[model samples]
Target: MIVDSPKIKNLIMSYLEEKKGKPFELAVDAGCGTGRSTRTLAPYFQKVVGIDVSESQLSVARKCTSHENISYQISPAEELPLEDASVDLINAGLAAHWFNPEKFGQEAARVLKHGGCLALYCFSLVFEIEYKDKSEELTAAFNEALLILLEFHKKVVCEVKAMYQELFSAIPFKDKQRISGICEVFPLTVPEIMSFLQAICSYKEFLEQDKDKATAFLQDLEKRFLDILGESASDALGFHVYYFCLLASKS
Candidate 1:
């Protein structure tokens, strides 16, 4: 159950709304795993399609989705199973880092109507836990925990760290813009934050390499957070995460 940042979604929609000349008809959620990002498009578009390469993920997405106008399909991001000049908006939420940028760009260019928008967005994994007085210590501890898993990061991970600067260049759209330093704050408990961290791909890779070491590292991270707070481990804390978006429009 991956939950996308609502503020980021709202930001993307706002930009698209500002730039569009006509009503939004069809929106595509490329690499829409579990349909979380797909569901967000329902209210704005008459039709929304969630595309993914994994049936297993689409199965969960289907089960979770209740919007009748929203549908799911199994397809790669690079090869969208959609007609030419059909989609008004194509959004890939956090999932674009795993895609073949060149092919995906060509497909996006083919499917997007004239003046259609393609928005790719992702949040910084390196975020700080905002606690009361010990905010500095807590943030440092949390970031340090993430350092243990850096060895497992894939090459695509670097694109995210650079805030999609390279991917923005690869988007094949003549009219495009890169927006960065968009910050959003969320309230989450230490355990909830841990759950989010564990869901990251690098963490899974770290676990595969050494399960016992990974488990120990996870446990230590929680303990460190709790010690810094000097309170209940389940106590909610503020998470200040920064996000970046690359917006491209077809000419």
Candidate 2:
């Protein structure tokens, strides 16, 4: 599951710099999976720690991550292992919805230094393909296929769909802001998009329910996408994603 959030990170950095100046000492990537977001914070912070409950994910992160300042720990978001008031930034990238927000907020407040920043962000599953003649048809078909996955989606996904309102309210920081409709476009092929679909929790559950049917559903979706584009699976397609972010500062 690739969670791309460079834009959000840049925005967080700008906010931090405006509030606390440059060279942030430490950044904590809460519930970081495979450390993808952790690596993004490496350039902005002197040290970055990725905390997760999955040892398997951390093992992969340890092997794949090359940044000298990046480290992975098997820890939960609600209970961090760091010292009190030691972290400058805390980022929960697409993983905040799965956490116990009240407990996690307490931990965030406990670990964050005065004026430290907390950023929580998540992207939507609905993607837009902007082909002049076929855009609407393509989006309709894709969304129709996506409905099956949504039906099987977990509660956390529903929380994300609600834009993490409860989670945002649970944040201990008094100074907070929420931004929505942050769109990002990426060039991807039909196969690449299917790979992303396969990574979703709902898709995984669907697969477990009936692998053959799940496989066939994705295959059909890909075929429909290719048919609409009038291109091969290898042909590049534009995918527009919308994300929402919540920023809070400890005072």
Candidate 3:
């Protein structure tokens, strides 16, 4: 399982705690894919339920998760299976962009208790790498490759690029704020970076359209990156990801 950034987890939990107070009773990880973000909520909330539309994803989530307080469920972000006004927090990490805004808003309003909080967050798709003096060169290559992938997933790419400003604005909660430029750095090699990029939904979609072409495209992009990094291709580089978030409270 992918180890999610503790920095991002801490930021989300701390910010929610600040607004709603600690020892939250129930928190839902809406659209929790493979329970990566859901597991992060365990310590802060008494019970953390991970809800996703895909049972296959939920199966992986259940297998990857061991937190006694965490549970998995199959549900949609626009329509939760929980009781009305029963949740303290609803968090969607890298998943809200796919949800129907109006339906999700109503569902959130229905499930959240008075003053309950909703947190939606995702990292920038294109990450920057700091490798000796070749940081800018590698970053440019990544952006170039991302543009190639963008053609296959233009809508998702555009929404993320805008930092989900439209979704954030559509949240019915008047008491809400959008935060941007939260940077988190991780150690990852060039190959690891390539693997991460390929795991994106856009790339997977591209792969489904033409397997050989997609495979060749990714290989070519990896070659370009390796060429740019030289000897540092095998060495772990500082992968810097910027996170944008929307935090809101139910009235």
Candidate 4:
């Protein structure tokens, strides 16, 4: 099991606790990739639906987390299969950006019990990183990496743009909803960093089709990592040097 961080666990739990024992027995995990976040809600809720747009990921969720109270389903954030005023909470971890907030917020409000909370949050770069000595090189690698990430986001820009327009334009459901944006710095080690780069960045896939760009990217990262630590690589990830987290909430 992955170690749960105190701050992250608290952020979610704090909101749930704020309900003051209202019994969050029914909840929804929208965009529940890999069932990681969904499983975390198990102890708090009696019936937790982990919904994702991808059937492939849902299969994995079914296999990995077979809890009796936790169920997996294939559904889009824009339209959920749940009934109105039934669920106690709806969560989107690192996934709200991919959803249409107009549809999502409206759907969320429709499905949730009045006063139900919605939590939107994302994980950011770890603070324990140490790549500052080779400041210029590291900065270049980080920025390039982010640009690549942005390019990935561009894949569904239409849905996102429409979603943002709807949410910001106050065209969503529940006039009594609340929005919150919060950020926190955390730590990550070498293996964690490498896993993140591999799983999330799709670096290997990018390399296969775009060898030249991938070559340039890795070459630059290599130079920076070596520069900061001479022959060996830097072991400590830099502290609070990144902004990889985002949050939006509605109640």
Candidate 5:
């Protein structure tokens, strides 16, 4: 989802361009789950390193990624392996909510060179759908169904839903800023949308709590979405997802 997003890529590029300095040599993707964000950084930086605490995720990333300038490592966000003042950019995509913000901030400050950039971003679920006459009703139903799933969300998910207010506040950088209401429209099928929701960690945890209820909720959601589309499960649907970003620069 993060890699296939053009808006996100443009946003990252625009942020880097706004800094307007020497080209970045090394970019660090902190808490990079499967190297999606790491690959996104490859074209912009001389070398991109993806760091995650999960060995399984790193193994998957190594297997899936073919970029010569990108590498995957097993490391925690609070204690990165990079040298101080070595990295030119540090990005945490959809993963900052899980980090100890203060420790990660200190580590980021240590690793990033003067005038380096730091970006933390995450996107919400498909909050709105663009169909014919049923857009409003479908969106309302989607929100209602999402509220049920959110009941089992982890604390970190709540932090993200709050637009990373706490995480932004923890960043010690004086040049920090927040950008919100960045929306992306994706053309996907009803089943595809449901699959995206199932991929979410919070939804997975919710499924673990009550598999029957979770299954029913997903089934109902799929049905509702399809019904609004007036087409089969394979029919294409347009979904709008909203995102927020926190950007900072080392002085």
Candidate 6:
């Protein structure tokens, strides 16, 4: 937890002070992949349920060491098993985008006790700065690679905006809910950045699923990154701007 990496446990701890040492009666983690954040939630609540739709993912989560208060279940974010007004807080860490927001919002409202909190943390690979003082070719290549990601995800994968509205204007927090939209630039080194990408995206799957297009895209990416970043991605470290942390409440 003390690691200065972009670990979710570390981010959860950043908000620990707000927890104010108040013990939670019940808590849950939506899409708690591999229990990275599930272990963190255990200590705060009398009981914590780490839920995921994928039993395979839950299997991985269960393999991790956990506190007696911690548990895991296979369930979708849109349909949690808990009753209304049953939980003190619920966290969605870098995994909320995979949910149906209209359903998720309703379930969250259903499970949360009066004045309970709904916390989330998500980041994009868009705001990265690398290739500084590098050769022109390498720098240009890096820029092109980054741009390709934006083009593909934003232009192609148009359904990813449920969680990153950048503001709470049309969010579904209840009328009496208290919401805080947090934006922070957390600096990350190369390995940490790669791990973040692995957790949030699936470049390998994309490449495997459509080898021809993926190969072309990657070839272009390699050329651009090499041209601008001075070194191939394998050689140089990548950095990303980790920026969103939204916390809301329902009363």
lDDT of 3: 0.85
Candidate models: Cα lDDT each: 0.85, 0.85, 0.85, 0.62, 0.82, 0.60
Reference-based TM-score of each model: 0.95, 0.95, 0.94, 0.73, 0.93, 0.69
lDDT of 6: 0.60
Query: Model 3, which residues run further than 4 Å from truth?
Result: 1-5
Comparing 3 and 6 on TM-score, the stronger one? 3
Q: Report the lDDT tens digits of candidate 4 across residue range 44-119.
A: 8889999999999889889999688999889898899999888777877657667775677678768877656666
Error of 4 at 226 (Å): 3.8
Q: What shift in Å separates residue 130 of candidate 4 from its native position after superposition? A: 3.8
Model 5 over residues 155-176: C-alpha lDDT tens digits? Answer: 8667977888888888888999
Residue 101 of candidate 5: its Cα lDDT? 80
Evaluate model 4: give its TM-score.
Answer: 0.73
Candidate 1 local Cα displacement, residue 11, angstroms:
2.2
Superposing every Cα of model 6 onto the true structure, what RMSD results? 4.9
Give the higher-TM-score candidate: 2 or 4.
2
TM-score of 1: 0.95
Residue pairs of candidate 1 with colliding backbone atoms: none
**What is the per-residue lDDT of model 3 for residues 126-192, given as tens digits with 9 covering 90 to 100?**
5787888998988888888878887888888888989887887678888988888888888888778
Candidate scoring better on lDDT of 3 and 6: 3
Those runs of model 2 whose alpha carbons end farther than 4 Å from true positions after fitting are 1-3
Task: For residues 11-48, write the lDDT of model 6, one tens digit per residue.
Answer: 54444435423556887999888887777777667898
**Using lDDT as the measure, what is the rank order of every candidate, best first?**
1, 2, 3, 5, 4, 6
The TM-score measured for candidate 6 stands at: 0.69
- Residue 136 error, candidate 2, Å: 1.7
Candidate 5: residue 232 Cα off by (Å): 5.4
